[model samples]
Target: MNGVDPLGTGVPGPREARARARAGTAGPTAGWAPGHAQANLIAVPADWAYDVLLFCTRNPKPCPVLDVTDAGSWTTSLAPGADLRTDIPGYRVWEDGRLVAEPADATPHWRTDLVSFLIGCSFTFEGALDAAGVPLRHVEQGRNVSMYVTDRACRPAGRLHGPMVVSMRPVPARLVPMARRISGLLPAVHGAPVHAGDPAALGIRDLDRPDFGDPVVAEPGDVPVFWACGVTPQAAVMASRPPFAITHAPGRMLVTDVRDEEYRLTL
Candidate 1:
C-alpha cells in the first residue's frame, strides 16, 4: 500500500488504518477506513464461545456475527495477519462481568482458552450515509458516536443475556429517509435505524448522556437516529458475568480488509 496520512479522516486505506490503530495513535475509528468493514471484538473462554456465538445468532440485529476465530487464535479472515491482541485502538478487559482494564495492547492479557468473535459495527455504514449527503454529527465534531443501552432485552442464549445497545446519529429530518434507505442495504453492519426521533422510546432518557461514547451537538431540525450497535455483546458480558472476557472498547473497532460494499445488499 502507498503511504498515506494514517490519522487523516477518510484518508488511509484499511491496511494503513490498521497500522495506525495498532500503534494506538489513531483517534476514535468512527469514520476511518471509509470503504472497509469495521467490527467489534468479543473474546471469551473456549467453553463460553458457543454461547456467545448463539447469542449473536439469536440476536442478529445487535450482534451480527461477521467472523469467529478458533480458540486461541488472534488473527481473523477479516484482516489477514491482523493481531486481535493489539490491532484495535482500545480494548476492555473484563473479569466476572466488570471492566478491569482499558488497554491499547491486550497481548499480555491473551489466553489460550479464548475464542474471538468479530461483530458488525454501525460505523461501517457511516461512509454510506456520508456519500448520500446525509449529515453525521459525530464525524463532524470529531467525536465518538453516542451509544446507549436500552431497556429492551435481547433473546437469551445459553448462558448469555442482556439489553440491546444502540448507536445514535443525529440526522437532518429531511435526509432521514435517505440515510435509512442507504444504511438499510447493509444488514451486516447493524442495518437501518431501529428507532428515530424519540430517544425515550428506547428508554434513553437523556440525549446529552450516553452509556458509551461522546454525545455530539445536534443541529436544529436534526433527528436522533438509533441503530443496533455491536456493543451489545459487552452489555451481555456485563449482565451474564462470565468468568472472563475481552471486548473492543465502545467506538474503537477493528478495521477489517473486507470492503463495506461486500455486505451491502442490492436493489
Candidate 2:
C-alpha cells in the first residue's frame, strides 16, 4: 500500500483499484495491489447456476470458485463494500450466448435474478513471480496478458461445454523452473504451468496473435508458458450460448480483500 506496485509504477490498492476500475480509469489489475488476490467475474441467471457450478467443479483449474453470490445479489464476500455491478474496469454482456455489449459498468443490465460468481485468477500468481524476480513482459509493456483458446476440451457439465483457454507469458528459459515452483504454491490461483516451451503442442500456431488480450514478443531464450485461464468460463458461456450472461473483460478483474498468501497451499 505504500511502495510502488510490483509491476513498477504506483497503482491503487483494493479500494482505490476498484474505484478507478468503476470510473473506467484503471485499465487492468495485473500489477495493481500486488499482495491482494484478483478474481474473474461471471454472472448468470439463477436457472443456470447449477450447471455453471458443475462446470466449475469439473474444470477447477480454469474456474476455481472463490465465492458465489446469492441470486439477485451483486455483493460478494470477497469485497463486502464493493458492488460487482461497477467495480470491474470493464464487462461483457451476453445475450443468447453472443456478446452484445462491452461496457464500463453493467448496472443498466443488472437484474435481481442474476447470480454473480468470483473465480480465482492467475494474476495473483503473476505477482508472486514478480516478487521472486521474474519479469512479466505483458505487464512490463502495459498490456493484457495473451490468452488463447486451445484444442483441448473441458469436460462438459450439463449445458456448458467449451474448449480450454490459457494465458501465455514469456519466461526466461533459466527462470522457467523457478516460475513453476513459485506458482505451484498457489493452487487456488490456477496453480502451475499447464504447458511450457512449445506453443504448437497446445495448438497455438502463432504466439503473436491471441484469442483474447494483447500479445507480447517473446525474446530469444524466452520460453512460452501457459496456464489454465479463468477466461475458459467465458468461452464456455459463448459456446453454451446461455440466454443471458455477464463476464469481466479480458484483463479486467475483481480486486478482492483476500491476500494472495491465503491461496498458497502447503502441499
Candidate 3:
C-alpha cells in the first residue's frame, strides 16, 4: 500500500483497497473503504458490447451503468491509475456460459478487443445505513450479503435476458423504512430496497442457501430487504453466453474514487 493513500482523508480509499487486492491480501470489499463507491465489473467482446449496453439500459435497477471503457482499454475515468485487469481482488472467467475460472488477476486473459463496464453496486449504500444505526447482518457476521435469483425476468435486449438477481440484507423491521430512505438517495449505486419482509415473494424459498454469495443469518425481528444487484448482468450474460466474458467475483467489487455522495440523485 506504499503508493496508495491508505491514510488520505483519514479514511481508507479505493487505491488502498486496490493495493490490497493487488497484493493478494484483499478479501470481500463489502466493508472496506467505507463511504467510497464500489462497482461491479464485466468485460465482453466489442461485438457483444451493444447488447450488453442495451441489456443494462433495459434493466436499470439491477444493471446501472457507471463507467464504460473503450475497446481494449483497462483504464476508466472512475479510477485514474487503477488497472481493470488487476485491481479487483477476484475475477470470474466464463466460456460458453459456464464459469471456467476464478482468478485473482485477469492480466493473462486480457484481450485487445474487450470492452469493460463498471456497474453500480449495492455495497456503496452500506456505509450510509451503518451511519444511520441500521444493523447489517452480513457485515456483522463477516459474511457476504446473500443474493438470489428471483422469478422476475429482466427485459430482453438483443441476445441478453435472464431473471433479475438481488442482494438480500436483513434490516430490522423498524429500520426498514429508514434504510429505504437513506439508500434511495443513491440511484447510481442500486438505490434502496426493491422489496422488503417477504423472501417468498421473490422466489427465495430458503434464505440460508443463497444462489450467490454467503447466507447471512437473519435474526429475530429482522426483515429481509432486497436490492437490485449488479450481478444481474452477469447472470444475463451467462444465460446468453457470449462465448467469452469476465466479471468480478460475487461480493468482490472494484472500489472507485467516486464518493458515495456523488451518486445521490434527486428529482
Candidate 4:
C-alpha cells in the first residue's frame, strides 16, 4: 500500500521500483519503460474473479487473460512488480451496468476482497497493421477505437454472459483479406474479423453511432471489419452488477513484461 509516486518526487529506489512494477509501466523507458509488456486491466471482487477467469478461458478471443492478481495483492508478479491500483493512466468504475466515475487511481476504492485481471488488447496488433500498409483511421484521427455490442453471444461461463463487443476498422475491399490475415496470427488479442461487409449482419444498426470510441469514415471501396473486443468483458461485468467492479478506461492498458510476439503463438 505504501509505494513511491511515479511523478518524480525524487530518484526512484526500491519503493518506487515496487510502485512502478505494480503499475505495469512498459514502453519508452526514457520517460516510461519501453518493450515492457502491456495488458488490459480488469478489477473485480475476489468472488467474481473466478467466474470472470472462467469466462476469459471460455472466450479467449475476446477475453484473453494475460495475468491475474491474488486477492488483496496489488503487486503484479506476472508482469514484474507492477501495481494494479495506480499504474494505468485512468480507471473506470461501474455500478449496475453504468459508469459512475473515472478515477486517476483506484487506491481510494481498493478493497482486500478485490482481484485484478490483465487481458490482451488489439493495440498489440496495430504495429503489425502499419507494417503491412493498412491504415488505422482512428489512430490517424486521434480518436478512440470504435466499439459495438453485437448480436453474437459469447460462450457463457457462470454468471458472465453478454453480446460480444467488437472494434471496427475500415479496410479497402482489396486489403480486407490481408488485414484479416495479419490479425489472424494474433488470436490471443481478438484474432481475425468475425464479420465483414455488412454491419447490419452483426446487428449494428448504424455505423455513425458507436457504443464506444469515435466514428470513422468508411470511405469508398472500404469494408467494415469487426474484431471481438476486450470491452466485451467490461460489458458483461457491468450487466452482472457484481456489487463493485473496476476496469481500465478505453485506450488505457497495463503495459507488461510479455511481448506482442507471444500472442502469435498462444493459440
Query: What is candidate 1's lDDT per residue for 1-267, written digit by digit as tens?
Result: 022233865488778878887877645787778889999999999999999989999999999999999999999999998999988999999999999999999999999999999999988888878877787788778788899999999999999999999999998999999988999999999899899988989999998999999989999999999999999999999999999999988999999999999999988
* Decoy 2 TM-score against native: 0.96
Please list all clashing residue pairs in model 2, or write none if there are none. Answer: 97-241
TM-score of each: 0.96, 0.96, 0.95, 0.83
Kindly list the per-residue Cα lDDT of model 4 for residues 208-252, writing each as its tens digit: 899977788767888899988888888897667677888887656
Error of 3 at 147 (Å): 0.7
* lDDT of every predicted structure (CA atoms): 0.90, 0.89, 0.87, 0.74
Clashing pairs in 3: none
lDDT of the structure predicted as candidate 4: 0.74
In model 1, residue pairs whose N, Cα or C atoms come closer than 3 Å (at least 3 residues apart or on different chains), thus clashing, are none
What local lDDT score does residue 258 receive in model 2, on the 0 to 100 scale? Answer: 90
Better of 1 and 4 by TM-score: 1
Worst 10 residues of 2 by lDDT: 1-10
Name the top lDDT candidate.
Answer: 1
| Strongest candidate by TM-score | 1
Alpha carbon lDDT at 168, candidate 1? 94
**lDDT string, candidate 2, 1-267, tens digits:** 223363344665798888777777657668887789999999999999999999999999888999999999989998879999999989999998899999898999998999888998999987779878887888777778899999999999999999999999999999999999999998788999899988999999998989999988877989999999999989999899999999999888999989899999876
Error of 2 at 147 (Å): 0.2
Query: Which prediction has more favorable TM-score, 1 or 2?
Result: 1
